[model samples]
Every structure is written in structure tokens, then in C-alpha cells.
Target: MKKKLLTVAIGSAVALTIAGCNSSSNSTDTDTNKLLPKDATIAFAGVKAPVTDAEKRAILASDATITTGSDSMPLDLEYNVFARSGDTFDHAVFGQLVDKQGNPLSKEDGSPSIANSNEFTSLLPRGERLFSVSQFESRPGAMFLMELNQNTENGELSVKDAWQIDQSGVNGGWVHCAGSVTPWSTHLASEEYEPNARSLVTGADAAADRYAAGFLDYFNGDESQWNPYQVGWNIEVDVQADSGAAPTATSKKHYAMGRLAFELSYVMPDEKTVYMTDDGTNVGLYMFVADKAGDLSAGTLYAMKWNQTASTGVGAADLDWIDLGHATSAELSDYIEGANQLAFTDIFATADANEDNSCPDGFTSINAGGNGQECLQVKPGMEKAASRMETRRYAAMMGATTELRKEEGITFDPTRSKLYLAMSEVARGFESFKKNGADSSSYDLGGPNHIQLEGFNRCGAVYQLDVASDATIGSSYVAKNMSALVAGVPATDSYGDGVQNPIVANSADYADNNKCHIDGISNPDNVTYMSGWDILIIGEDTGSGHQNDVIWAYDFGTQALTRIQTTPYGSETTSPYWYPNINGWGYLTSVVQHPYGESDSDKDTGNGENRAYTGYVGPFPAKAE
Candidate 1:
């Protein structure tokens, strides 16, 4: 194959240049006769090695190398920090809580409270200036906007102003997680782990009570107006930033998309079709086709039905979408406003299973959202309300598969007509057709036995879905089939035995303390696809699956997985996004969230205060066409 030469500059003041090459052995290589677009490619010398140093592993570390594609003059990875958790700008702290009037919030002791779990950071370029929105993942979630100034000469970004976006309009955001940038140049954020209104009002869940208490603070201790149904939807933020005046943000919640634990919603090239991944055990995959292009106000919701094709590895399936009906965001908002006082029993009729775990003939037996088997029948005249408000349960009632475990992120590959989804783990409902192999119809009953993998891999896998036009859906970007693209290899096959052993540190048989293969991905969370380069950037959110979470660069043409960045011991690798070109520069945005917050919490000591980091990988040169 012929190689294309490009120039890459390194260092601050002194520009050291070298030749970068784009060499591909696959059939998908760029045509030599055709001119490469400005966003087509970037040249890198080599991948970084895995971080294993005890001290370095306890903090963010990057050794990735880039080059002018020359063998010599290789450049080390350069991470540009935009801001940290508590960094102050525009008279407001980055992760600090603020009220509707932009006043800092305080805890019960009258002490300033701050959030450290920054999950998604999106940089939206408007005209000559740049804008960014970062969401804090907490009980009463918060989102902040920052105005950034780019030094055109060197591609360095500096935060000029920052302030929290008010969420009072949507009953306050909850558990904001992974997000994406829409085709219409807006920020699409997600509210994960939607509070189960059923359990919150029907039963006594201490965890739910605690969450309600914390969330009530967002309303100034107003419990009478607490509505769980108002949250758990996709939020779109339209940032209006002009040359002279400060930037203003307007947010709207898209209830047209069914309520579930959304990891992220990825809009296809068509702009009208969207794929939403639900995170958590016994969750379901969903897609929404909007009535109008670039508008999410009204849509038809559909859930995926997985038809198992293979039982080996992470399993393969032919996908069929189950239509869960449609509604407008305004209509769904009306339902929540009117039914705020209603309990789970008011919307659905339920019956307890017999001692032998068999439900009565009338009610449907299904398990969803990790909720145990329940016999439920949607009440009359509540089908539309049930479908939008209780999406997972309604999907199960419609015979859609709800067996996905920790389904995390979704990114589209327009060139290949493919969509990649991250399943943080391949365990629980994914490992068996029948829960616990029970013969009784009511025992651990779910929507359908669609996925049945041979072994349990807690290390997780990334699945690829083939997309094509469907006349029935009236959209050209519907997913038709799915299979594992890249999967992590667990240290042991815990299938059937039901014994999950911890990672054996310093084991001579395995490499170091890693429970999964050192080279493969572990707990893949948020993924982004670089368009012209055909590279999928995957980030990890793992605990025992791997000692340290790392970011990977998977080249589709070469089928090579390269470790590009590694985070601290307990931090999660998040918000890996590709901005092909912003002004004259290209960037790969990355966010390291909650350092030492997971398994390594006890290891957090000294000045390493476990703050989250929002930054980008590089300021690569913009390729020319």
C-alpha cells in the first residue's frame, strides 16, 4: 500500500517537525488518487504502554506518542487541562452547587458543598469562540457551562468564564451520565438510573429514601412537589454565545424518548434517528425516530428484541425492534404533572407470585431493571402513559428483550453503516436464558430468552450493530443485526459455577493484578468514532476487572487495539469524543472522573485530593483536502 505523508509539530515555542504517514493494509484505506479532507486523518508514531507503577497508577498518567509520521522525532502525548473539579471561573466554582439564581448552595452544616463526579464534557464551537458544558453525576445533578478562548497560534484552550446551568425547569436533573453532541450543534445529556417511581412510593427502600432526601435539597426541602417521573430523560442544551455578550443556555427535556437508565443517546447521520443505550442489569436497548429532523419534541419509541444466533463468546443476535408507541414531549410532561400523586398500583395491576413462583394467569411475568419477577398488567387507559413513563417494564410487556447488563455508550459509524455500543459487563441476565435455570414460569421471569452466552465475562465487551433502512420505521438508519466486535477476556470462566474470584495480584500465571487480559478492554464505558480515520476511542470504568482504567484506540482497518491513556486507580475514563476540526485544530476530548473514588478510595492520601479532570488528548494539525 502506498503511504501518505503529513507534517506534525511538537513542543511549545520551538516547532520540531517530522513526517507523519498513513499506512493501511486493509481494503478500507483511503484512495491515493482522491484528496484527503481536512478532517480525514492524523499520523501517530506509536501507542503507549500500560501503566503499572504503583505511584503513577494512583493518578492520571499518559505515555501515548504521536509523530510527524517519521520513525524518529516521536512526540509524547500532551494533555491540555481545561479545568478541575473545584477550579473557579466567572466567580463560580467548576463543580460547586448553585441555586436557580446562581447562588452557591450549602450543606446542612452551612458548609460549601461541591461535586467531584464530572462525567460528560462537551465543547461546542460557535463562531470564533468556544463553549463547553460539563455535567456532575450526583443525586441532585448539576451542569456547568464555560466560555473558552483558543490561542490560535498553538491550539491551546483557556477557560474564560464558567457557571452552572439551572435545572429547575425540568424538576432538576438526576444522575447525569454519559452524553453526546447532536448533529444540530447542541449538547445532548443523559439522566442515568432513573429513580424507580414504583419502588419509591410502593415500598421502603432505604437507598431510595436517601436519594429522595438529597434530591429534595434541589427544591429547597420541598417534598410535596417531588416528582420522579419528571427526570430520567434526554436533555438538549442550546448555547447562544455571540461575540460581545456572555453565553446563555436554554435546556429542554425530551420526554418523547422513553424513560430509562440512559447511558447516552447517539443521533445518526440522518439526524432524525437516535439510538439510546440503557445502563444496568436487565435493561433494554431503545431507538427513537423523531417526527422532524433536528427536533426531539415528538417521536416513536422502539425497544430491541434480540434473537440469539450464537452462544459462544459474547454471543451474536439478529435484532428486531418492538414499537412501544409514540407521544410528544409536551404530552408526556402533562402526564407527569397530572400523575405526580399516583402510585405504581394506580398505573398497573399487580399480583404476587404463588409459593411455587408461578404467577396467576392474567398478569404478565417479567423482570426488568434488575427488579425481580413481577406479575403486572397495565391498567386500562394508561397504555400511552405507561409506555413513556415506565419504558423498561412496558418494553418487557411488549415482548422486547430486557437482558442487557450495563449497556453503556452508543456511537455511529456512518462510513460503515454500523453502530457501536458498549456493554460494561457481560454478566447477570446476559449469561442465561432462564434466570438461575428455574423451571417455574414465574421464577426470575423476564421479557424473553434472547441472549444466552456460554460464559460470564464481567470484563465486558463492545458490540457492533449493522444499520440499514427499514420501510416500517420510515428511517434509513435502523439497526438490523448485532455481534461482538471487541470483548475482554476474563481470568476465569465463572459460568455455571457461580463463583467469581477476585483478581490475583502478582500471579505468575497472569500479568500483574489484572483480572482481564492486559491488552483487551475492561468495562468499556463511553466510545467515540473518528470519522475519516475509522478509529473507535473507548474509555474504561472498571474496578476489579482491571486495576487501572485505560483509554483505547481501536483501528477498524487494522483491527488493532492500542492503549493510548490510563487513569488513576479508582477513576473512570469518560467523555472520549472526537472533534475532527474546531476552527483550525483537531482534538480528542477526554475526562478523568472521580480519582480514587471506587476500589482505590482508601489509597487516596496527601494532596492527591481525588478531583475529577476535564481535558483533551491533543491539538493535532488539521489535515488538508
Candidate 2:
């Protein structure tokens, strides 16, 4: 159930030049149609932040649908799935009924699909199994989220069976890449975030896009036996998981998030943790804390070095890193518990998506799209998921470094304290990732498919961090004008292969816009990716995505995630859908946020005025008591 590619290209209007090491003077102007930190202030710090004058006329006069309740928030679900090859393995749990514009009213004729389950076979004790849709049909304030799942359960996550959580379990089958969602409640589901290029050099072709439709190779080995490059991303599933969970064979590998090519990890309401460097080449932004996890007990993992950049730019010299002189951060977190080192080879010396190890070979276009390229084939020890040998000697050894390279969407900020980095591309700052001409090895990417969109140069950025001290986002002007990073593709899907940037066409969502930072704030309270505003969004059914792969919502304000509402979703020739990929979702790989509530902008006030509900986006209908 993999396939989710998110890039940040940036090349429109062409004719530019810069990356040749700016040296700073704040941004030594060479001018190639402009845009380098060029005073746009790096993009945007608060976008405007000045609001005050009576909260700017009450967001210019209210009615975005301000809500705390249109009603329906009660859920009791337990859909699960696992079992890949044969035996009873059918995996299908479905439901769809949307409204409020993202559409899909099922067929309006009373929109339906209500609740579903495809009878699971047996993954055992905690491998996966649980289902109880909250009466099904949705719409109240609308947001019956999550839109992909192969084995359903944890992947479809929607349960309230009063609440179970057997210590957190995992055995394993195909929940292979990416997971983490537990501020307090629990949604760690499984583990899987497949992709391994290590040094492919950018020919970029993850299979024509449409979200790559669930790659299916059926694992036997070759391209490097798929990949397990060490640095594992955790997989110990099974706890009664509110998720009717799935995917387990014998899962048991959590050496504290480290092992290149690993994906999915985020927890903070003080749970203390942060991960997602995904290095096949891409580093920087890797952290771990756990003060006291329901498990881990303790914590230590850090890597996020960035400084030395004044080649003429003028500002940027508070930099820090070069301290191998003694190695501290608690002796590299006990030196990985003893160094059997399953993954995260150089901890962070990781090659280059710009994390920095001077990537000559390792870059970062990554994969998991195109239905996982006919069943996955970008191998290298299963693309390094803790370098398997039964979990790479049980990695726990602490320290390692390539000096933080080309990092990607790792999370943490909803109060677990702070850490929200996202950079399959970052290095010029503002004028949207500085690229008039580039030359450290070249990196200028522009807009379309692969990068997910909404506005500007195909925009590719979501960098915000405060993880208390690891900090980040101070560059200013709201991160250099920031209105960029939008190419979740779909400039228009019309149907199937419409193909914009199409690296899998786009649908892994930075925030189906229910405004999920779940407290993982990648940039100011989960900078909710905006483009049609998001009431609930998740797309995939084909490359460049569009065959009814659904989940949508829109229109919100104050902080603005905009999706207004939805319920009783419908769909006919097209445009009115209510998802039900089987039991609950279909072939998914990642979606984390358990224990929930870690906010930044609910924007409520009364004493002096500013009661804006953070920018309510309205339209909540569909009900079924």
C-alpha cells in the first residue's frame, strides 16, 4: 500500500543563476530575475502577523464556519489489515461520503457506504484486527479522515472500543514504511517508508505519478534486496491498537529511530522524539527524546547542523558544528547502545538532498509512488529499514554523522516541544530555495507533479522547528516569502493520468488540511498545506493520482487550513466520492498522530476580541445518530 512522493522543484520562468556559494552580504546580488533572500524576507514569518486592528476586522467579518462542534465527534472503530501473498489475505475495508465541496457525496441519492469490513484472516494476538466504525456515515463538522490502507486496521485508525492498547504491538506482513502518531492516545500502527536510490543522480521517473498506485513486486530480491540500510524507523506493533490493525510477521525493531532510509516518527507533548531524515541521501533534522515513553523509557538522538554560510550573503554566521573534537550530546546517546549499528550509518553524514555531506552521488527524489513501481524495486537491503539481519545487530549504538544531509519531512512541534523540518530541497533560502543558476552540484527544481502544490514555483518548503533548542525557522520574512511549496500536483486531475509533475502524481498529504500538526508542527503549528484548503485530503489511485482515491475538506481561517466541511460523500462519472477502499482504506504506508491535541492556533478569545476559531472553514453536514 505504498506510494507518496513529495518534492519541491521551483524553476518557472527559467533564466536564473545563483547556487555558486553566495558568501552572504545578506545575499550578494548577482540578479538572475531576482528572488534570492532578496528582502522578500526569506518569504514569510507570520505572512503578515500584524492582524491586531481588532483581529483585522474579525478576519474581515467571520463565517468561515467557526466550530468546536457541529456535532459528531464520537468514533469507535477498529479496522485492521495484514497478510500479503496468499492464504485468506483479502484486505478491504471501505467507506466514503463527502460533501462541503471536496465533494464525493457517494451518489447524493442519500450518499452511502456507511460502514464496512472484509473479514480478516488472522495476523495473531497483535499482528492486526479491530473494527467498529462510529455508526459510519460522516459530516457533522466533517473530517472522517485517513484515506489509504492495505491491511486497514492501524492504517485506517478510527476506534473507540472504549479504548484498548496492549502495550503497543507488531508482528508484520506488509505495513513496510512509515509510522508514528501518539502524543498520548496511540496510533503507531506499523512501520514502512520504502525508497532507496543512494546515488541515482536524478533521472526522476517514479512511474508516471498518480501517486504511483501501490507498487507491487512481491519481494524476492535483486536491486540490493530492496533496502534496510540500518537507521530503522521502528516497528513493534499489536497493542490492542484502536486501529483494527494489520501487518506483522514478527516485528520487533526499535533501537530509538536511526538507520538511514527509515521513515515515520513524531511525538512531543513531551513524549520527546523527532525523526525522518530518510537518507539514501538527505540528512539534517534527526532527534530523539522519550523522557518516558510507554516503552523506550529514555532517549537520545540528535543531528541538525547548519551554519557557516556567509559567502557574501551578509547574515548567517551563528552556525555550529565541527565539534567532533570531543563528541558530546551525552556521548552520542551512549554510542548507539553498543554499536551493532543496524542503520543510520553516519548518523547524519548522510550524503545529500542538501543535508550536506556534500552529496556527489546521493540526492533525493525518493519513491513509494506508482503503486510502488510494480511492487517496489529501488532496493539496497530493503532500502535500509534498520539493515535487517534480524534488525542489524540490534542497533542502539549512539553517535554517527555525515553532518546532516538532504533531510525530508520529519515532524514534531505540537508541543512535544518543537521540530518540523521538511526539505527534499533547501539551501538558498527565500526567493524559494535560491536558484538562479546553482553549482555546488546543482539543485534548482521548479514546479509540478512530484512536489505537491498550492502556489509559487511549485513551492517546496515546510521548515519550522524549535524542539526547544534545536530551533530553526529564524531566517525571517516568514521564511523568505513562503507562499511556495504547493504541487501536491493535481493542478487538475480531470480523471486518471492527467500528469502534471506526476512522480506518482501526488497524494501523501502534508496535512489533509484537517490542520494536522497533531502537534508535529513542521512550521508553525503544522503549517497545513493549502491549495483547495483541506477539510480532509489524501489522494491516490493512479500516478499523478485521480481515480476516486479520495479524502477532502476545505476553508478555515485565523491560521487557515480551509475545507469548510463534508458528509454523505457521493460520486458518479466523478467528483462526489465517499472512500471505502475495502474494510476502511487501501494500500497505505504512513499517517501518525496519536494521543492528539498539541495545538498552536485555535485562535479563540473573548475578553478583548479575537474569537476567530482559528479561521473556521465550515460546511459540516452528514449525520447518522
**Which candidate comes out best when scored by TM-score?**
1
Which candidate has the highest lDDT of all?
Answer: 1
lDDT of 2 at 592: 14
lDDT of 2: 0.24
Candidate 1 has a TM-score of 0.88
The residue-by-residue lDDT of candidate 2 on 1-625, one tens digit each, is: 1111110121011111112212111111212332122111110011111123222121111112212223212111111111111111123222222222223233326543221211111111122343221111011111121222221112222222221111112111222333344544233422333333232212232222222111212111112222223223354433333444542222344544443444345554445444444422223334454434555433444433343333221112222321111112233233333344233343222323334322244322321111110111222432223222212111211122222223333433232233334432222221222332232222112111112111221112344444333333221111111122222332332322233433321333312321111111111111222212122222111111121112222122333232111111111010111211222222111111110112211332323121101001111111111
Candidate 1 regions with alpha-carbon error over 4 angstroms: 1-76, 99-102, 108-110, 202-208, 338-342, 433-446, 492-512
Consecutive 10-residue window with the lowest summed lDDT within model 1: 2-11
The digit string of per-residue lDDT tens for model 1 on 1-625 reads 1111110111111222223423211122323432234344343443343344443343332433332233333333455677788787765688887654556779779867788788888989887678899898877789999887776454556788897888877778788898999998899999998888877752234234866566666766556656678778899999997778878889999988988998999888788999999998789999999999999999899999999998877889999999999899888776776644445677899999777666788788788998878788999988888898899999998999988889998898888989999999887787664433333332135346677777657788999999999999999998998899999876544323244445533454345456776667888998999765668989999887677788888988788887777776677888799886565455788887887788767767746457777878765544443
Candidate 1 to native Cα RMSD, angstroms: 6.2
lDDT value, residue 322 of candidate 2: 18
Relative to the unseen true structure, what is the Cα RMSD of model 2? 25.1
Q: In candidate 1, residue 449 scores what lDDT? A: 60
